[model samples]
Each structure stands twice: as structure tokens, then as C-alpha cells.
Target chain A: MKTIKNGIFNENPTFVLMLGLCPTLAVTNTFEGAYVMGLCVLTVLLITNFIVSIIKKLIPENVKIPVYILLITTAVTALDLLLKQYVPALHETLGIYLPLIAVNCIVLGRALSVASVSSVGKSLLDAIGIGLGFTLSLSLLGLFREVLGANTITVMDGISSFTGYHAVFQVFPENSIIPMTIFQKPAGAFLTLGLFLAFFNYIKEKRGAAK
Target chain B: MSLFQLFITSMLTENIVLTKFLGICPFIGTSKKESGAIGMGISVTVVIVLSSIITYLLYNYVLVPTNTTYLKTLLFVLVIASTVQLLERIIKHHFKQLDHLLGIFLPLIATNCAVLGTTLLNVNNGYSFIEMIVFSLGSGLGFALVIYIFSTIRERMEFANIPKCFKGAPIALITASIMALVFSRFF
Candidate 1:
């Protein structure tokens, strides 16, 4: 329970720790995209944590990390297949990024950290909490990206459009916004993250001063 | 093209650090001191080259036929992490002086995305084992090259007066973008 609590709000992976920014910035362009990807990680983390927990002691200490990794790949593989068959379009937008998730520092970080610490159930809860924390942060980033970057709040494009109050996401009418286009590219992701980091620090300073 | 061409291109035309943007965390944090930068470069270069070769072989011989290529990412990380573990042990035993110098930076190899990036790139790019070795070396060297250069600039930066807001990561990132822009011109 404490592990779970630490993973979510107390020691949040994204905002507080700033550990897994790669995928968080890359995929947060849309709400649904963020949700789907976050859910995928959630599923992977939970299953991997549970499986690794029971066998944690059986594996030699020297080989534990590799063994954990092998266990994770199985979960990722299964996830990749499931996404492809059911949500075909998301399967496309995600593209290589999905496989790239295996290298994501967060998933592996959780697997190693939680597995080394707690009970099977405790690990399972930790995976869930962290997974949810990751999902929440990603969804927020997606919302910010979706509203500011584009004029529309699109979900799956041609399949359907979740419209109304959507177009307001654009800060400016078609030609008015320069797009700060950098924000939309990989470099923009960094710049946005950097600026926000400054903003977060500023807020923290103010709060601490108040105390 | 010739092997020389591939090697040359990997270093310049397609530098791993500036172009790929794989290992920014260390590039920013460790580039404050020149000697640390150089040590990091050499250590990372050795790890990248060695690990990629092993991962390439493992993929071809074991994972592919077993239909477990999906497991490559997990497997590669394990290999790299354990190898790094061994590297720390060897450094402690064999090269006490150098190890003392590189003491803190040693285990960081596990965290550097460049190392993981290389092993994954070799498998994904399907470089022949030879090409894998060359690419790994070139990438590592390119990484080493950039970090060393950045640290030299930062060494001078210590003497310069900088603004309050843009002191650490911000200044480092702006420097990175500039370097990246310059590197992009080559490609």
C-alpha cells in the first residue's frame, strides 16, 4: 500500500521524478492517444510486477534483472498483439513507439524497483498506482498538447470525432497562431518540458516561502 | 559503399549524440568537467561496442530461431546491466587509480540511453555482426566526441557570468540545440 502511494502522488514518476519523459512528450498529442498508451503501460506494469514478485527469490541475485526483463518482454509482446487486433488505428499512430516502450525507463524502472522491495500483492498494487500515475500525467500532457498544438480534440480521426468545445483548444484562429511549431516537434517537447520545469520550480518556491 | 565510408558517416554524417539525441541526461549532467567527460566517453565507447556485438550475436543465434525476438529489449538490457556490473568489479580490482577517477560515473552506464540505444539499433537495423560492431564504435565515438567538446566549452563557461534563470539544464539544453543545429547542417 505504501509502495502504491509512493508511486502515485507522493513520488510520481512523471511530474515529480521526471523519469519517463520520452514517451510522455512524444505521444501526448491527443487525449485518446494518451489514454490508450497509458492503459497499455498500466497493463504491462501490473502483470510484470505480479509475475516477477513470486519468483523473485528463486532467481539468483546476479541474474535477477535479466530475468525480470525477459518476463516484461512477454507482457509487451502480448500487449502489442492485443492492440493491433482490437484498436487497429492506435496501433498505427503508435507505430515503432510501441515497441520502443520496452526501452522506456519507467516500465523497467518499476519492474526493478518494486520487485526488489515488496510482496507479490504489494508489487501488484505499486504497479497499478504507478501505472495510473503515469496514465494521469500522460493524459494531462496530451490535453495540453491537443488543445494548444491543434484546433481540434480528435480521437481516432476517421473512425469518429469527439467534437463540440473541441475547436476552442486552438489558442488562435487558423493563421493567427504561429504554432510555435517547435512545440510540436521533438525539440519542442524538450523546450516545453524545460519551460514547464521552470514553472514548476517557481510554484514550489512560492509555496515553500509561504510556509 | 566501403566500410570506411560507413564508419566515417556514422561519426560525422550521422553522429549518435547530436543527431539521434539518445543520451541527453548524461550529456548534460557530466559535461560540467572536462576530465569526467573524457572518462565517460571512453567507458561508454567500450561498453557500447562490446554490448552491441554480444547482443547482435545473441539475436542471430538465440532469439530469432526461438521466436523470442520480442524479448530482445529485455534481454539486451539484462546483458548491458550485467556487463556494466562486471565492468565496475573489474575496474575496482584491476585499475585502482583509474577506477578512483571514474568511481561515480561507472554505474551510470546502465542508465545512459546511448548504450541501450546502440544494442537496440543493431538488432532493429539488422546490421551484420561486423556492421554492428562498427556502428557501435562509431556511435560511441561520436557520443564521446560531442561530450568531450561540450565539456571543454562548459569549462570556459564556468568563468563566464550567466543569468539566474537559465543556469543549469536550461543553458545546457540551449547549448545542445545549437550543437544539434550545427550537426544537422552536416547531414
Candidate 2:
């Protein structure tokens, strides 16, 4: 329980650790893409952490980094293949980032920091914590970007041919200045993340003061 | 696409850092100081350009011939890791001063998405050998240019009165946001 809360709040991957910013910023233009990307990372993290913890003793001290890289790459490749086969649209949206997950610091970092040193159960819990933290941050950023940039919250989009996209909530009028279209672009990604970070920092500091 | 156009597109219009969001870790990590930024830029260019050539050749000659393109993510990362290690050694032996500046960032480059991302993009775009060289080199220069400018801006930002919560990464990101906004006009 503490581990989960720590991951979600105290050591949130995106807002706190700031690892894996590439996918965090790139796919976050839409809510669905961001969360999907987050889940993919979460899956990879869980796999790598579990495997690393299990085989920690077998891996030699000298060659651990390469071994970890190979492990992560294999997991990401498998995930990529699965996504390509089952959800081609999400795969298309993720593009290079799907493969790029192999290099995502969070996976390797967890393997190196947590899994390599800890018990299997502990490592898995840590993975869950970090993965959830990552997903939460990505989803928050995605929700903000989609709502402010496009003025529509995409509940489901390109998941399948039948349902299609449904923009659930309309916050501002279509032609109003309230919804800044710039939020949809690359620049908006940075700005939104920056502001979000500042907001989180403010909350953290406030809590610290109370303590 | 023509060589000049490709160069411009990679460097400015679709920058690896500001636009593509690749290498944001280092972009934020190393840009705290101007000198560190320069060191990181040069080191990244050396690695990206060198690894680009090797990965391109390996992909076409080896991976394609063997029908094992699926191993690209694994193989390319190994190649990049080796390149960074090799470059670190060479710099240490021949150019001690340069090594001092770049020594810390060298290991980090192996995991930098820009190096791997640019290599994968080259293959994805199906660029010829010359085009691959131009694109990777341009991307490296673009990474260097943006980081240098950002470092300078950040150096000045030290004097500015910033909010308590928005001191470090937040402000830098916001600044990059503005930079991205400007760079988007290139399109």
C-alpha cells in the first residue's frame, strides 16, 4: 500500500523523477495515446523488473547493463508486435516511441536500481508503483493537452473501426479563445508539462510546510 | 528530398529536442551550464553521426540480408553502447581536455533517445547513404545549437526572479516551450 502510494505521489515518475520524457511529451497530444503509451511502459516495466529480480543472481556484475538492455529490448519488441497485430491504430499513433521504450530510463533504471538488488516480490511491487505513477502523469498531461488544445476529451479514438472517436466533453466554445490551439502542438506539450510540474511543486512545498 | 532541405528539416523544422522531444533528458540535464552543454553537444554529435553510419550499413547489409530486421532495436542499442564506450576511450587517450568535459555525459548518451531515434528514423525514411549522413549530422547540429542557446538563456535566467515552485526544470521546460513555438514557424 505504501509502495503504491509512494509511486503515485511521492516518487511519481513524470512529475518527480522526470524520467522518460520523450513519450511523456510526444504522445500526450491526445489522452488515449498518452495512457496507451503509459500502459505499454507499465507492461514493459513489470516484465523487466520481474525477470531481473528472478535472475539477479545469475547476471554477472561486469555484464549486467548489456544483459538488462537485451532483456528490455526483447520485451519492447514483443509488445510492439502485439500492438501492431491487435491494435494497429494505437500502434500507428505511438510510432517510433513504441520501440523507443527499450531505452526508456524508467525500465532500465528500475531494473538496475530496484530489481537487481531487491527480492522478486519487492521488485514487482516497485514496478507496479512506478508504472502507475508514470501512467497517472501521462494521463494527466494527455487530458490537459487534449481538453485545452482541441477543446474535446477523446474518450475513445481509433481503437476499432466500429465505434470511432467520441469527444465526450466540450469545455469551451469551438471558436472561443479559451481553448488555445497551440496546446495541440509540440510547444504546447512543453508548456503544459512545465506548468503541471510547477503546480505539483507548489503542492509539494505546501505539504512540506505543513509538515 | 534535396540535401539542403533535408538538412533544414532535421535541424530546425523538426528539431530532435524542442520538436521531436527526443533527448529531453540530456537537454534538461546538461543545459544547466554553457560549457557542459557544449561538451554534451559535441559528444552527442560524434556518437550520433558515427553510430548512424554503422547502424545504416549494418541494417542494409546484415539485417536485411539475414531477414532479421526485427532485431534492430536490440542490435542498434548494442552498437550505440559500444560506440559510446569506444569514443570515451579514444577521447581519454588522445584528447584529455575534451574527455574531462564530456566524460560524465558519455555513458548517458548510450541511452539517449536522440541517437537511437535518429538512427531508426533514417531506416524508416529509407534515406540513401548520403541522405542518412546528412540527416543525422543535421540532427546532431540541431541538438547542439538548441542546447547551447538554451544554456545561455538559462544562465541569464539565474538572475531573474522565479517563483519558488518553478525554479529549475519547470522554467526550463517553459522556456523550451517558447522556443518550440518559435521553431514551429519554420514549417
For each candidate, the DockQ is 0.26, 0.90
For candidate 2, write residues A90-173 as lDDT tens digits: 788898999999999999999999999999999889999999999989999999999888888766775654345454677777
Q: Per-residue CA lDDT of candidate 1, range A1-211, in tens?
A: 7766788777777767767554665666676677778888889888888888888778888887667766776787788877767667667777555665666677778878776678988888888889988888778767666666665555555223322222223345677665544444444444555565556657766778899
User: Which segments of candidate 1 are over 4 A away from where they belong?
Assistant: A1-9, A25-36, A52-66, A84-104, A111-115, A119-122, A142-154, A157-172, B1-21, B65-67, B85-106, B152-167, B185-187
Docking class of 2: high
Error of 2 at A146 (Å): 0.3
**What docking grade applies to model 1?**
acceptable
Fnat scores for every prediction? 0.11, 0.90
Q: Which stretches of candidate 2 lie over 4 Å from their true place?
A: A161-173
Model 2, position A113: C-alpha lDDT score? 90
